[model samples]
Target: MHLELHIKSGSRSGEVIRLNEVGSQLEPSSWVKENEVIELLLRAPAKFQSATLNLYDHRVAATYVDFDENHTNFVWKPQRQKNRSLECLFINYFGLAELSVELEDEEESKVIKNFAPLEVFASKLNAQNVEDMLSYLATLGDEQLHSLFQTTKHGAGFKEGSTSPNGSLERLEHTIDKLSFLFQSLFSKPITKLLPEHRVLQASGEEDLDDSALGWLLDNLSVVEEVDDIDRAHFEFNDRMYKAHSVQVPVLKESSNLYENQVVHGFIVTLLNEADKQLTNYNRTGSLKSAFSEEMPEGYSSFFTQVNRFKKELLGNQIERCVRAIDRLKFLKHSLDKAIPVTNYILDRPILTQKAEAQQSYRGVFIEYINWFERSCPDWSVYQNLLAIKSIPTLFESYTYYRIGESLNNILNPTKKGQKPIGSLMHDIDGNEISLIREPTYWMPKNSRSNESLYINSEGKVLKSGKVKPRSSQHKYSHRCPDVVIEVRKENRPSKLIVLDAKYTYPTLAFSKYLPECTMKYVHGIHNRSNNKNLVCSMTIVHPMGDADESLQSFHSLDYSIEGSMPVSPSLQALGLQLGLSQDSDRLGETLKLLLKQAGVAIPENLQLPLFIS
Candidate 1:
């Protein structure tokens, strides 16, 4: 395929430059600047019926025209992507091939590309990102990044004891508790039922003349040998000869030793044996290890730390607890060894499954055993480590979470920190604890707040007539959800709220369409139902583009005009901050401090600050 680049803007406007193929890399006449649109024209092989262009596995639309019997021409306007090096895959009926091209914004590209670890969550994991992530994972070693990775996996911290991805292992704890209760119940009062046993005796003794015996004798009178001496007339009884008549009698026997007990006991014994095997195997093989080598991979120290800590803290703890529970269960079963008889078959019948409680408890034990058998093996440890990954997200969103935490940590003393769902507690210079809440859903309160409280979202109501009211902005018809929210709690006053959002693209492109819709909603759309008052003080859009300072001017000029009934000003304010890879890291902290100051929150400047503040 012959490819040509048509520059639509800049000094090279109206210029068409042929992209020279140098091995795998395609060289353009001049470097492509960020946000610089270029019309890519491709001449396909005559034999090829169609062609497609894909960026990082996502298909880009191309305008195609059949140029004649010789070849087909296609034009595609490729936009600026997040990464620096654009690997365009030209897919056709024949096969798949890749073309790599470089851009002018190499530094920004490098920054954005470093987020390769975030690619794991892409709808489709293609070759490009995988290669990038693997290459980057080879040089990771930053302790700070490592710490961030550890916190990001779970909002409540790694040791918070939340349910893990291993379904059966989590259920094992509950199952063990249930089994303990079951064993206790059995030991206290076992299942006892009345049974029947039969006896046959000679009819000589008077003691055997009871009603039951006589009735039995009369019922089988033909067996009497009163005159049956010819056939088998005589029988020895107590050293005396007697008639051959015999009485059959029934006796009621009560015992706890039944088939159900035996079956359950055998099942427990089997679990004990399996547990022993699992423990022995686990002991022989140590805890799950990291996939990467001891030398930290380049650009992926944080990712490595995350995966390692996850395995050690979460998976390791789970395995340890599971083994302990199994041991406890075995001990309990051992105590009942003499009480319940050893059976030839383990769970021969479905007696445990017949009862509701027993069935649930039995399921837990069986599930634990099955999960261990399939996943807890020494060889399966690698698979478990792979499954431990849970952060899965777009790089910007993930980066924004950590970025906010990092930025705040510089200016504020961290009292508490958490991730996954994302929340944190930090004290600013004033010693007041501020909360950073991310993606929290709240039910709207009936009355407007008189004291400090987070803004409540309207979680639709169900009417008395069985109809439902859709959730909206308090009393309004729409609701707005922000990416990150900072709340400053006050002593005897209402808390202040500041909203921050992470946008991967430039503000110019975003505000042109749905971006304004989102920003405007956050400013004027959010309100309290009781008073219809706006809850937000200020909202900032954090973007990755370096030129955001200029592009956001137009967005900042735009505002929503509230009507007469509204309590606040007619115009609401929305600001934009340039943030992300290659962007100034301190910008976010400074912007937040300014927002707080404007909201009348005080901060002490006497404390020693980081040297990078200038």
Candidate 2:
């Protein structure tokens, strides 16, 4: 009795295994029950999942399949994440088979015995049709792919905690992660949708079509070193090591000259494609290892072989976009006019004026940059790096000095409206740091509250705090005397407010475990021990490189949890950004801009000193 069996793997494919040549009575063993999940690592196994193999249970839907000897077939059905349902699909045995997934409802049970895919692929991968086989393997399902074998740690630098990607690793890791997902998807789906009863004949699996003509489809990497091992022939084309090879200096002088002439055409299109392939290959197989076009894993060959199909298409699309037409900048200019025409920076404040330095806030800095941006680059392209930084959310205040006008590398470029908010710090009109702010804070809270006091030389030490609720109906939260506070002293411009917080989460700074009370205690206890001045100028409670992760959100709960530390951005900075709103590429772009728009604030511009002739 040929029982129709449904297979259960996380995938949508099937595998044909000899369950047992022993059952001459030919009945499937009850021990091999239905809906049983047999995980073969991340792949499917060699058995079916159903009891009545010929009579369908109608529950299994397939995602992928394994075709054996061009005749026997095993198809996989991916598990549905939402419903927890599974699919049973037919496996395509031959070339360029589209993974067609089908759900087996009770109504389709009558045709259970006819579920077969190899017959269709058989027609495609026949002796006379060897050429199509390579293309078919090129279209290999995604699930069948895996990286060349790097431990999880090898890719660590690309993760959030480590230093950001700079050199080749950045591009490589991106491609690996991208291709991993892409390949995994292919492996997890149905490979062919052959009608039941199709007798797919078996053909010799290895065909002569594995020739060089089909191998060139992967992204065109500038061959640093290449050879065809098939003939044991040594032919060096573009020979150079990648790490030793710098984008700054092309390894091959000829290639460099060619690139120089076609830079605009190269960088965006071929360069990106080649870069994509180079990275993916390096990520999968180490840079010193074999090329990605070599072959899939061992068991992957049984089901489908084509792998880099989508990658090839992706390269083609990029090339078409790059050499086709450079979008007109004038057309982009007209688009910006819809917003309010701010005369000064979007955020206006004195750049480094004494009064400006006196204020410890981000709203002021955002205004300063907005003012600077408009005046400095009235013709600034919409795609500038400073603008890109705004997409990140919480940015380091220090980045402001270092980042400006860097060329846009597409890998790091933020999408059109998705940059991070700007970083915040108190700067003197001269752009010198008067003090550092731990978080982005709104200088003005709705109901507009601030803490002002005249200290009468109190013996008590702790920095006092004020918590004034907002009176304005539009404002919701009350303003608290800055998260931390300091008393005005005689040497310091007293009658002044030193409303700021110290940035602590930074390892360089004291951690949060030493926050509030202990910090306040130190402030009240220490004075005149080191500095010549009798007074400490100002005070603040901030984390270095203030970020929302350090400030607003809890660092403890993140997947990459930082134990006992505050998030990168302070809550105050977030709240203030919420209040005075502004855009910095460091801050996620839209929110910052929205907040900035709401505050109607702008950064102070760099103005020429008033000429004074005595």
Give TM-scores for every candidate, taking all chains together and pairing residue i with residue i: 0.39, 0.17
Task: Please state the error at residue 522 of candidate 2 in Å.
Answer: 3.7
Where model 2 places Cα greater than 4 Å from the true spot, the runs are 1-265, 269-433, 439-520, 525-529, 532-614
Question: lDDT (0-100) at residue 529 of candidate 2?
Answer: 21
Best by TM-score: 1
Stretches of candidate 1 exceeding 4 Å from the true structure:
1-75, 79-254, 257-316, 323-480, 487-496, 503-535, 540-614
Best model per lDDT: 1
Candidate 1 per-residue lDDT, tens place, 489-570, comes to 6675556666666654434544564356555556554554445555567666655444325423323333331212331322
Query: Candidate 2, residues 473-511: lDDT per residue as tens digits?
Result: 223322222332222222233222233332213322334
TM-score of 1: 0.39
What shift in Å separates residue 56 of candidate 1 from its native position after superposition?
Answer: 12
Location of the lowest summed lDDT over 10 successive residues in candidate 1: 110-119
